[model samples]
Target: MKSLVTAIQQRDGRALQAMSNSVPLQQAQPVREHTAQVFNELFKQLRATFPASMANFKDQEDLNEFKRQWTKAFAENNIRTIDQINAGMKIARQQENPFLPAPGQFIQWCKQGESLAVGLPDEDQLYELYREYCKMRGWREMKWPSNACYWMVTKIYSEMRSKSLTDSEVIKLCAKELRSMTARIKSGETIPAPVKQIPQLYIPTSKERSLEHLASIRKKLNLNPKSI
Candidate 1:
């Protein structure tokens, strides 16, 4: 039991798989239920240990290995309740770096429109550019509020800044690049790889911009009283 907990803590898929395989299956209904519950908690802990991209395995072999280990752990533990299986997982999570952004923080960052650009290419415009880029890559149905999409916009902005391109020129060049990349991918000549690092955008917070806009409106109203 201690070894199994340690395996889970280490995220050792192979060890967990071996331990699970060592356990003999019980035909009892309560035993099956308990095993199922343990499996769920084990998977939840494993999933939480990594980012969504890692959790969602791309290779079939990797996915199968995880599943095999997950099942084996459940059988060996014979854990009856969700809480029992989750206790060790909770402890493991507590040992993780607290300063790292939580899942909610990542989502909040997306909502806040954080970027690495010096100026120009606002959040809305960036989102539109991301949409176009995705469409070019045959992901026309893809939406924003995703790290990948955000990174794409930032990469484009970075390129624009490095080249000192105007907004219009950036748009034109990005469109052309997307088309070329899409063509390569469709032809099986290249793999789709977007920027991995997050970019710093120069855009201000929505609140700050709103206040400035309101101040401008007031100034205009004061200049032309009848326009109010």
Candidate 2:
């Protein structure tokens, strides 16, 4: 583990890859403990090296959250090897904001918004923006259906661009609605479903002129307007 940490610190890609391939096929308990130790040391080295940027977690909770998110991200990206770990850490260090929404959390927010019919932006639009965000982050190498980082970054940017509510605001509104519904239920009062707004009909500006032109043409042809 020390050697792996040293190799990672030195950015020795070959050595890291070798170490990753050489991990022992031991009992489940021992393997889990060893993997945890390796990762702990790796994270320590990363924090030591990039204190200002990627490792700027606010507290232990924040760090743990990041770890949870990044662990999922790594697994989803199929980053099982040491070389992949090193590469991911390098990319993370270069990220402008390494902290973003977890995938499950972002999806939950979207689902809640949809269920409440709160006028959330279209899912296709959100996905398009997410792709753009990935490109900007130079994460094109990462697999699609990206991890939580991509989802969170895209959600933040889309909300900002559209002047939409933040996740916290949405969650608060949903909570309030739920509480109100619960109260009504306990009081034996009727609870109404949320109303869906009717979309406005579209009228073309040239419709009247086109109709008049068609009438004139019909008259020139001596056709009965009503019968035609």
Candidate 3:
């Protein structure tokens, strides 16, 4: 029964269904009902987590279209194992590739987007969640972590790379450079030249720029910048 909870947590509905089938008919009925309830709750949490995206598909037709595809994929597929089911669910939940930021730019994303905390916890925390989920399923840890785990590792590496210049050793080296530069200036010696800035050319058009004019121009070009 606890395995069903784990399967649900892992979004392995097919695994849950398989586990449910293994139980006595009477037992399976109640378990299936409970699993279904849990699945609904998970979906509600997902919607809450991504309210902005969900809002875009608030219309019945769009919502139904999404549900229809989801249902058809789950129904038509024969998921033979727990892992396979897990993989399928992962594919379904895959978000459009989000823009990644450099360590210096991360602060800007936090300020600009609601997705700031989407992957709040580090990879270790998520791996712990996976362990707990697997334990509840009465399953032993696998010899190797799944591709999802590897994905987490990759994210951690990306974060580490982004912060490379801020590492203690690198920072110390930068401090040395600054000191060297300062000493040269103090000694009345010539310092290294600074980076040159290129001024951008700003050309103003004669046409008035307004919402009305923009709309007219867009209509003429048959282009919708908003769609981009």
Candidate 4:
């Protein structure tokens, strides 16, 4: 159960649902503890192999075995789930795979608004791989406005970009996300912003400090600062 919640945080719906099913109905708390124990064991095994693909786990013996088997398969197949995740990163020069956004244009803007979302890489070379994943899981698609991608892109840029993102760039992204959101949601749309947590620290005005006020205070106090 705990592992299910953790998977949800990581946005692993399949893992979440599977974890939930593994829990016994009557023994909820005990089942949760067992699940956690199993999850931890599984996590440890996967951590050694396909670290990126390993979702959260509860600490339970049964869960551990499950994780171990999954990890073994992943390792044997050289299926680097983390690499796939990295491929979805926002700042990539490559195009997003057509299969990733799965439902694609069908996903309504009103449904997701402008918010952060995740999907597989858009690389055409991975067409076969994408198709396989889609055939199995149906692309794990979500409907979100550009804001979802913007958040991902900015985060990726921050992590990998040679140059840091400017306030203007971030604002532009925000604006673009808003535009995408509006375009997607028609009137009577109940869609909310994808990233409801307003970017507090990224606002452009926050970067500029007021030196003039400091200078005036220094003059009034008769204290000469070493540098302006």
Q: lDDT winner among the candidates?
A: 1
Residue-wise C-alpha lDDT for candidate 3, range 1-228, written one tens digit per residue = 687778888999799777777768876466455444433443464465456666777688987775544333333332122333332234334545333222223222222121112222232344354344434422343332333333333333344467764445443433333333333444565433332335556766656556657778778889976742
Order the numbered candidates by lDDT, best leading: 1, 2, 3, 4
> Candidate 2 lDDT, tens digit per residue, 1-228?
798789989999999877666665443445455445545655665665566655456688987876666555434433344533443444445546645434344333323333233222334443354546546643233332323323344445555457766655544443444334433444565534323335567665698889888899889999889755
Candidate 1 lDDT trough over 10 residues, lowest sum: 111-120
Ranking by TM-score: 1, 2, 3, 4
Tens digits of per-residue lDDT for model 4, 9-34: 89997997666676655455554445
- Candidate 3 regions with alpha-carbon error over 4 angstroms: 1-42, 78-228
Which lDDT values do the candidates have, in the order given? 0.53, 0.50, 0.43, 0.41
Tens-place lDDT per residue, model 1, 28-95, is 55676766666666566556665564546779898677656655555553334454444444434554
lDDT of residue 28 for candidate 3: 47
Pick the TM-score winner. Answer: 1
**What TM-score, over all chains together, does every model reach?**
0.26, 0.25, 0.21, 0.17
- For model 2, the local distance difference test gives 0.50
Q: Which of candidates 3 and 4 reaches a greater lDDT?
A: 3
RMSD of each: 22.5, 21.6, 28.9, 20.3
Better of 2 and 4 by TM-score: 2
